[model samples]
Target: MIPGIIWRVLLIAIALVFAGVQLDREAGKTYPLAASVPEQFRSASQFPMAAMALDSDNPDYTLAEAERLIRRRPLPAEHLRILAQAQFAAGATDESALTIQYAAQRGWREPLAQETMARLAIDAGDMPEAARRYAALFLRRDTQDALLEELGPMVLSEPGGAGRQTLIEIVGGGDRWHNQFLRRGARVMPADAFVEIVSATVANGSRYDCDLLNQLERGLTTRDEAAGEGLKTVIADQCPS
Candidate 1:
């Protein structure tokens, strides 16, 4: 009887071990592991591990190590953006600009990427390109005037504010450079006063109707109260109730 019990126990143990092995194999098939690191860089494994460290909120020395790896290997756009952000956080504006530009040139036209390019252009005194990029993004009609407001100083500092006005007129403001005049009247003028001009044109019924009122309302919330009230008076006087 004792021999039979031992035999049964051994058989069950073998079966359990076989089942566990099969389960592991199935899991491996379902979720394949990453390839083994090549024998090139002495710290090749550290790159991804550093990235994981960034994600895990336990960067420790990983950020410094990741910077070294990036300098050596030059990661792809996704990783490059992370490194750029890190540079930005460290107040290394030039390094951030270069890294972001590399990603942008590589066809990463994300909003953040585009904004970074614009910032780089502004930093390099390339006002025309900065204005062009900002206009292209503004025409999407998604960004807010706060961003334009932030860009005002740079635009005004440019040669005669030419690029800034060009961006404003492109978005639907009328000719004769009255756009800036109107924006000033509305008290919404920024360094790039064209944004205000375009906003006024849209708010004043030159474009779509009540459907755009929501956007106008959001703009009003951020605009000068006096300007907003004046605009409301104009709408009440001009547009039908």
Candidate 2:
């Protein structure tokens, strides 16, 4: 009753006819005798570093190289994205999904990896997962927080969409870290659009603590300082007294 892992190892050994590779237990790695290894796999031996030099954008070549690379050795987790993207390019849906799952379990969340997973999820018609992955990639503290000011106008359009709702919640929250950017957003975004978001958030029953409300009141004042007459009217009507 050999375990599945042992069976896989045995199968791999059999595939290569038990070629002149030995596990150097002291060093904890398998060392292959080059002469006994098949010619096809000889180049794969260089892949620990060579794989990084490979052109990842060429679908045909990348798919083939990545496929062969994974078959011969366990790659570094950061490099697994090349394999995942290649698998998707080759239309190996199930294999790509499994590879992506494996990469996640190993804690690989590089930008390219996130993009690969998102693409695969979209290709598989898993919109929720795709959207979730895409959102996760951008919503991190380092990524989104760095550009919180820039995010305001980007999410201000589409009058009643989820993006607007999210902006509303963010603006009304106690996190002052982005409050200045929120104020900047209100000033830079169109007066009408900014007013609409504020009014709707208040209308929609988004409760803000007194401190945040005070901040918002001060924020809107500056936002109106240079606003046009119409924008000033809208702000005065909706902003706190």
Candidate 3:
């Protein structure tokens, strides 16, 4: 009877050993030998869903959804840029600017964000801010001359004549891009108005460069030959030396 009890105990121990081996083999097969769990997976499972929400077919809906997600998780800088753009699309310029500024402050350094901020500053009538942004952009190594040409007049229009001089200084020479900006500025501004503004700015600042002033005078004259004489007459009367 003792022998029978010992035999039963031995069989039970063997069965347990065999079951342990099977479990170990199953676990080895289920998990890749070199597989590592991702850190993001541990942080939150909702990240992917939040990211996907940004791609909704309707821009407004996507923005709204992203805003909701951002409120919940405070997405990374890239996502924040998207959120800023969404705010811009919703006509919330102030909010968009703030968001983009946050990204910039956080070292995002996205060109699009800088450009958007510059545009926002212009729209907000903050000429100084616009000028600062344009200056920084102009100094960038990768700045596209074509884009600068398109953006120059708009930047110049911010501070009126003073801004025009800055644009001329930045543009320098008869580069095609600079000429394009000059032509665009001329077309958009009335010849008399531009002349008057430039004259006033020149009068106020004694340190103004003669060559730049000459270039502006030439540009104003070439804008519309018919209007040039009239503009000169207006300038002479309104802004006499």
Candidate 4:
């Protein structure tokens, strides 16, 4: 007859081996894609549902899985983003909005979260908030030019000027993106509005190089000669006499 302690040891070993085999099987199912291994493994280790959270086609399932993952220690921003995205897709607008804010609070550096925030703000008719979110995105070199191109016209046409001014005040703080914004504004904005923004930036101690001025002049010139001359006059007057 086997000793009770020896039998207990054998049973414990079997249970551990079974658990290991199960874990290995789960890992295989979760990690077929090499690219997702590094990021997804960390989440999967803490919450077994991470695989479904990331891979599920149904937004409702993804949302539920992400919520489960987030309940573990050190809430993952990526999971929060997944939750927010899934919520948005599932027509849970109010919940998605709140979840995205939680994600953004975790880190504003994520482009998708910032974009989602901006879209939500736009849907809420909050242009300033939208511009603020885009401005944060504009700070990223990869996204700056494309966003400037995409949003320049909208800013130029912003009614009440509040949204435009908000962008100017933020982007005008000597970030490299503002130069392109001004150049694009010169072509797309009404001459008066372009001049006013330039004058305002100058008043706030921002200086444009001759190249930028020359580019704006050329862009305005190709669009309208009278407007170009009027812009040149404004530039000259705004400069030290």
Taking all chains together, each candidate's TM-score versus the true structure is: 0.43, 0.36, 0.39, 0.61
Off by over 4 Å in 4: 1-41, 44-55, 72-78, 144-156, 175-195, 223-231, 237-241
Give per-model CA RMSD. Answer: 11.1, 10.8, 14.5, 6.5
Model 3 lowest lDDT segment of ten: 33-42
lDDT of each residue in 44-68, candidate 3, tens digit only = 2223443454555666776775575
What residue pairs clash in candidate 4, if any at all?
none
* Candidate 3 ranges beyond 4 A from true positions: 1-55, 58-61, 64-77, 87-98, 104-108, 140-143, 157-241
Q: Who wins the lDDT comparison?
A: 4
Two-way lDDT contest, 1 vs 2, winner: 1
Show pairs that collide, candidate 1: 152-191
- Angstrom error at residue 40, model 2: 19
lDDT of 4 by residue, 1-241 (tens): 5699899999998997666655644654565432233333344443445445556678777766666567653466666777777787778989878988888768777677877777777767777887787666666556645655555455445533766687668756765666766765664455655666676777677777656686688778777787678668756865534
Off by over 4 Å in 2: 1-80, 89-91, 101-109, 116-158, 166-241
Candidate 2 residue pairs that clash: none
Which residue runs of candidate 1 sit more than 4 Å off their true CA positions? 1-76, 83-97, 107-112, 135-149, 156-160, 169-196, 199-206, 210-222, 225-241
For model 1, the local distance difference test gives 0.54
Tens digit of per-residue lDDT, candidate 1, span 1-241: 9999999999998997666555444433442211133323224343454455454444434456458657755755655766676666566778877877787666434456667777878888887778766654453345556765576556544433666555545544444433333433223234224334444455544542443343353465466555455445444544556
